[model samples]
Target: MQVFVTGTAGFIGYHLARRLLEDGHVVTGFDGVTDYYDVSLKRSRLAALQQYPQFSAIEGRLEDAGLLSETLERAQAEIVVHLAAQAGVRYSIEQPQSYISANLVGTANLLEAVRAHKPRHLLMASTSSVYGGNTKLPFSERDAADAPISLYAATKKSNEVMAHSYAHLFDIPTTMLRFFTVYGPWGRPDMALFKFVSAILAGQPIEIFGEGKMRRDFTFVDDLIEAMIRIMPLRPELGQPLQGDSLSAVAPYRVVNLAGGHPELLMDFVAAIETALGHKAAYTIKPMQAGDPRETAADTALLRELVGDLPRTPIKAGVASFVAWYRQYYRV
Candidate 1:
């Protein structure tokens, strides 16, 4: 199988591409190499992928309409996984325009490319943040996600709608995965675990937003890739939706939440990092920022019924793996 994956240089994308390549699939990766975080880290990830003969990567943004179209056609991608986006909730608040250009507009460009060269399955990344302002304990696919608290969440929700339209109009079998807080080895620096680990290791005070009261469903990266691969083979049909809360009814488009199933407290997560690194964190508590949810817990029963399993990576073990990788990679 030949797969076209965007954001190949990203944490999740890198892991996903590696897994696909190891599974004997030819993968073509598209990434912009943006300076949103450490560009060197992105480069290092791409470098590792380039070692695989079956993997090819192109450095370009999703909004580059011409480049994206050409690559999609050239790769002759059978499966398209759109993961490239200007990701970060707090960053979205400061730079809303970037989110619009990448998450929203970039998604539109990818959809256009997919429309031109229809794939067997189009799996794109959405975030659990779309369940904004919803007081629901465990958010399910059937819940109404009309109210997004941030521009980032709004764009992801818009992507779901946009993809649904494409699926309905063009009969594209599409799945929008609403990922929970994904964390693991080679993770992004912006995420809580990564930031906390780095600050603690460097003997710096880690900022605790919302006074360490927030909770998140932190899914491990390997489990995330496995679930994605499993779901890729099962495409939804045009009109027939799966029974129960498994699939969408309107079109061949359904939003599935891939999560760890357990929402861990922020302080507990920080404690896990401290335990792993053998050091306590210097904490500076602060108020919660706008567009930030106090807690995120996924109702992954729909995902489990479809894929038959959810991410089961325990926080302590996951943090240890990340710390080991970070030390090795940075030679700390």
Candidate 2:
């Protein structure tokens, strides 16, 4: 399969591209390699992907409609996975324009390109953050996600609607994946696990938000990738809705939550980090930051129906894998 994946420089994107390359698929990666965290990290990911003979990349922003369309048309991709975005909850508060440019305008350009060259399936990365302000214990796809607390979540929700409109008009088979708290090896530095491990290794105090009471359905990267790969071929079709589905009535599009359905406490997650690093992390309890949810738990009923029961990696093991990767990557 010729797969076109955006955000190949990102954590999940790098992992996904590597898996596809290993599976003998010709993959064309697209990334802006933004300096959101560390340019070196992004470059290192790209360097790793460059080793594959079947892997190629384009270093450009999604806002460049001409380049994006040209690249997509040339690739003749059978499958398209949209993962690139300005992807931080707190950062969106400070840099709202960046989110607008990347998530809004950039995604618009990608949709235009897709409209020009229709693929068999178009899978996009949405977030559980779209379940914002809803006190629902386990958020289902059928639940109302009209209220998003942050600009980042709002943009993602906008992406869902935007993609839905495209699917309805163009008959594009699209699936929107609402990811929970995803963590694992080669993870983002801005995420909680990375920050905690880095701070602990540096003998610094880690900040505990929501007084360490926040719970999250943390999905390991490998598990998320597996679910994504399986769901790739199960694109939604008009009038073919499954039981407990978020499938659209009018469009060939649906939303699925990619998660383990098990919510773990924040402090328990910290304990897993401590066990993984073989050292306790000093910490200060702090109030939850604005635009941050107290907890995020996904109802993955639709996910299970699409892809058989996924193997959920234990937090301890996942943390250990990430700690080892972090130590070796940083030579800590």
Candidate 3:
């Protein structure tokens, strides 16, 4: 299958595109390569994909309305996977406009392109941040995601609404995967694991937010990619009730929680990283910031039912793999 994938320069996108190419699928990657992190990392990811004959990449923002349509037509994409977005919760507090432009406006444009082209399967990403302040121990697909604590989460929730509208009106088969705290090799710099690893390696004190009380369902990139590909041909049908909730009854779209379904404490995760790097982190405990949740755990039953199993990469192994990659990438 020929696939059109956005954010091929990103961490998950880079891994996903490589896996797809390895499986003998032709992929057209789209990315803006914003200086959200290191542009060098993005370029390196693209360079790796360039080694594969089946991979093609486009450098542009997703909000570029005309560009997306033209690329979809030119690539003759039968499957569309949209992963590009302005990510970061704390960063959203300062750069709210970035979230609006990429998450909201950009997503709307992608939906329009899908409506025009009518891909067989349209899988876009959502986030566990949408769960908001709800004290739900393990968030399920049926739970209410109406209360988003951060603008980033709100925009992602808005994407779900926008995608559902397109799916319902245009009869587009769409699936939205609510990703948990995803991390691994080629990970984003803004993410906790990356920051912690960088600080520890430099002998700098790591900020332990909320007095190190936060826990997250950190899903490995490869496991998440596996779940995503397995779900490609399992797009939900219209008129089917959404699992756990009936909020999306009008659309042929359903939200699936993609995670390891296990929440690990922040300190525990950091300990694993410290072990991997053979160094302990100097901790500076700080209060939690605005729009941040205390904890997150995924109820991936729906995803399991759809894909027969969910990703189960243990945190220790995942951390070790990331540490090895970080050492090699930076020559630490």
* Best model number under TM-score: 2
- Per lDDT, the best of the predicted structures is 2
Provide the TM-score for each candidate, comma-separated: 0.98, 0.99, 0.97
Cα error, residue 277 of model 1, in Å, equals: 0.3
Q: Rank the candidates by lDDT, best first.
A: 2, 1, 3
User: What's the CA error at residue 9 for candidate 1, in Å?
Assistant: 0.6
| Angstrom error at residue 37, model 2 | 0.8
lDDT of 2 by residue, 140-162 (tens): 99999999999999999999999
Give each model's whole-structure lDDT: 0.91, 0.94, 0.90
For every candidate, C-alpha RMSD to the true structure in Å: 1.1, 0.6, 1.4
- Give me the displacement of residue 114 in model 1, in angstroms: 0.3
Tens-place lDDT per residue, model 3, 75-193, is 88889999999999989989999999999999998988888888898999999999998897799878888889999999999998888888888998888989999999999998889
Clashing pairs in 3: 142-244, 142-245
Evaluation by TM-score, superior candidate among 2 and 3: 2
